[model samples]
Target: MKESTGQTIMIQGEQTGILDADTVLITGNVSVPAGGTLTFLPGTTILTTGFFGINVEGTLLAEGTINSKLVFSVADTSGFYNLYDSRGGWNGINFLSTDQAGDSSIFSHCTFYYGKAFGDSINKMGGALNIRNFSKIRISDCEFKHNKAIFWGGAVFAEESDLKITNTEFSDNFCGTPGPPYGYGGAACFRYSDADLTGCRFYGNSSTGIGGAVSCEYSDVLITTGVFQDNFSGLGGALGYLRSNPDRPVSCNLFTGNSSLFFGGAISCNRANPSFINNTITENHSVSYGGGFYCNDSAAPVLINTILYGNYAPEGQQVYIWDVNSSPSFYYCNVQGDSAAFGGTGGIGFNSPYLYNTDTLPLFSGIYPSPFTLSDNSPCINAGNPDTTGLMLPETDLAGNIRIVGNVIDQGCYENQSGLTATGRVNKELQILCYPNPFRENVTFILPGEYHGNCSINITDMSGKMVFSSSSMKGNSFNWNVVTDKTTGLNPGFYCVSISAGKVNGSALILHVE
Candidate 1:
């Protein structure tokens, strides 16, 4: 070890202990022995000169702050694109099966870039963070970018380990080679492991194989409130869930703008029965089938209060099943097409036994720039299951709003705080006009001055249960404060109101109250 005047150290062999300086260079293989710990201070930088790796058979604690992040990278990868092996430089931390003290290991507010994995079959995995055996690890608030692996995970690979990652960002990572099952998971892969990811974002990652961003096989994973966008692959454009399903369902996520060369523009489920709830899948493209999702080999994903729209494919615009063994079920969802529009083998059909789903425009604020907030006239508001008992939804949606704002959860990822019910734009054909259509406490009904005091006003809930019934007192304009007036037993929801005042036009109006 050679220490410079500025406290920068150069390590040519194994290393351990605390690295509190601003710069540390690894010129050769480095290993932290078992029962040992390698700690990095805030703003510490670890730079690898060759294809060397920082082998961690013990524990690594890199706890940096938001203002001071620990960085692991190569010094220069200037002309790396011309050479396949040099594109992604340096070997990342190899948490081998021999590791024992890694269970309590934590890495937070760190940045990993330009990591690569390629050699024998055993070494060609996990470009950035590789783990094996029964060890458990926690990685939070980390950024991984421009990493590559010949097989398995481009940024991270884990087998038989419990990996908990939260609030991380993965971008521009890729699988170096595209092939069969081996070349998968452009960003991350897990096999026979148990993992939990929360509030993660994956975009601009790709593989010529299965998952463009993430792939899992024989692993149980619970991912909540994730965002996957603009990734592409041959099969699953964003995620490939293969033979993996955790106890808790993957909920309140957003999958958008992903494309596939073949099937499942957003997600592909193969022999995996993952439960998805309150997710928004939209604007994905597939050349053949299942623009939003593709399921095969006994895969049956249960969807609740999910929204799928604007997906493009030649056959199944939203979803496609390879055969009858796979049947995706939707409950209280907002789908753009009906059952007849779903496609599969031999004229097979999709199964969605629940009711109260709208098959029209959800009226989003916009398609891109995230959030995709709901407009006032959107039918998705208050469109979820009335009872939020066993739903197991996240407390917050993608936009950080309360998941269930009104009587029920919103249909998509965003909860509209403004409107709680679906009431289309008021009709001009009706002579009777109401101000503050989605009123909080009260609303005013204005007649055309031709109705009498006996004008009938009836209000019923969506289930056709009469909630309020009254006649016009004596004026052309009647203001009713439903909250204060005990005579009006009004509840918050969509109400169908019919007014018959002589011949003032016979029409039913849809009104909403919050």
Candidate 2:
């Protein structure tokens, strides 16, 4: 592979051909003109020295392997944050409308960082990627981080396009201005488009206007099997939708720890009636109103087989409707405090039937990554719509388990596979005893009396992050001193301990105190 130094174009002879170099340092902008195709090979790196980017009018194919990922970033990151004017850093990839003959652009296993969108009207959005004018594209296994946009879409903005993003991760991206019309989509904004997003995760993305994670307007967007965590914004802490109605709907996802200063701790809708099915909305907060959902301007969302718990707001702890034009209905959901929990005429109330909605306490596993998984004794089991024929259900649940485990679908994103093996074989739950339940520095785990030889012990925090692991412990009784084992210093929180001995696979929750 060749390496270029301060060159305007690395492959000047073939501007619309392959780029297979170890590193290419660019000092000026590069464009793949109409009727052209550009491909970046695996392990290729394009570093911009100043404000520059790749303009694609035809096609861009960046196919990188898992071991050799493709990178597009700035060469010098010094004073990167000092230039907060939103005009700093290299300009991102811009894909204009192309009527030329070519396949859809494909980007896989790529990392984009420190891209910025500024200057003119067309350049004021999509810090990392801008797709427009009926373009079709697919992005998978891509990571977008620490990018900024002046108006909308800190990482990506799509307009009048067909976009499909799979298994992509967005983190620490920001978008907005100081004015009242701040911005939209801290990580992504879609307008007049049809998008399919599956297995995507957004974390710590922020925007001042709406949609800390994503904002969709007049777009039929489908979001399935993803997580939106700790995102912040003015309207929707995680998502803001405007006049979006997809046939598939958003399902089997987790939304938690998101906050909004205005409305909709988890989601905000304006003239949008998106379907939310089998999702878990929890631990979200709104300083104004609508802890879980906020609706206005004829927005009437239908939620089925969902759970709303531990959300907080002044007026509505679970949901709030701002106007009579907006009406939200819930069916077979475990809503905390019930319809009376929310404040608004259009929300669930006594005038309308419960729709089989329950106020029962949803017994959750409380595990991290998936906090609202149903416990074995949870009342939400087998309590879904019963007839899921037209629901357009995914083949597998959020955890990759069978969508419907028992006689019916579960009430949340995760299907209860407790006591069931991979092949759908029935298994018995083993008993494990932890003494001195909430300990400060020491704890003991004892297995069942039937049989105990060697055991493997795994301890994970509430978020399912592994903290300690032990293997081949030759006894039924195992004593662990948290202070002595410097590696296993336990924190003050809830943790789950799993023990595997023979056919025994059992887990129990333990607490640590300061």
Top candidate on lDDT is: 2
Cα lDDT tens digits, model 1, 27-118, are: 88888777788888878788988888888777778888888888999877664443256443888888875465444778999999988876
Candidate maximizing TM-score: 2
The candidate 2 region of ten consecutive residues with least summed lDDT is: 419-428
Point out the worst 10-residue segment of candidate 1 by lDDT. 505-514
RMSD to the true structure for each prediction, in A, is 12.3, 7.7
Q: Considering only N, C-alpha and C atoms within 3 Å, which residue pairs clash in candidate 2?
A: 368-462, 368-463
Per-residue lDDT for 430 in model 1? 35
lDDT of 1 at 364: 61
Model 1 deviation from native, Cα RMSD in Å: 12.3
Q: How many steric overlaps does candidate 2 have?
A: 2
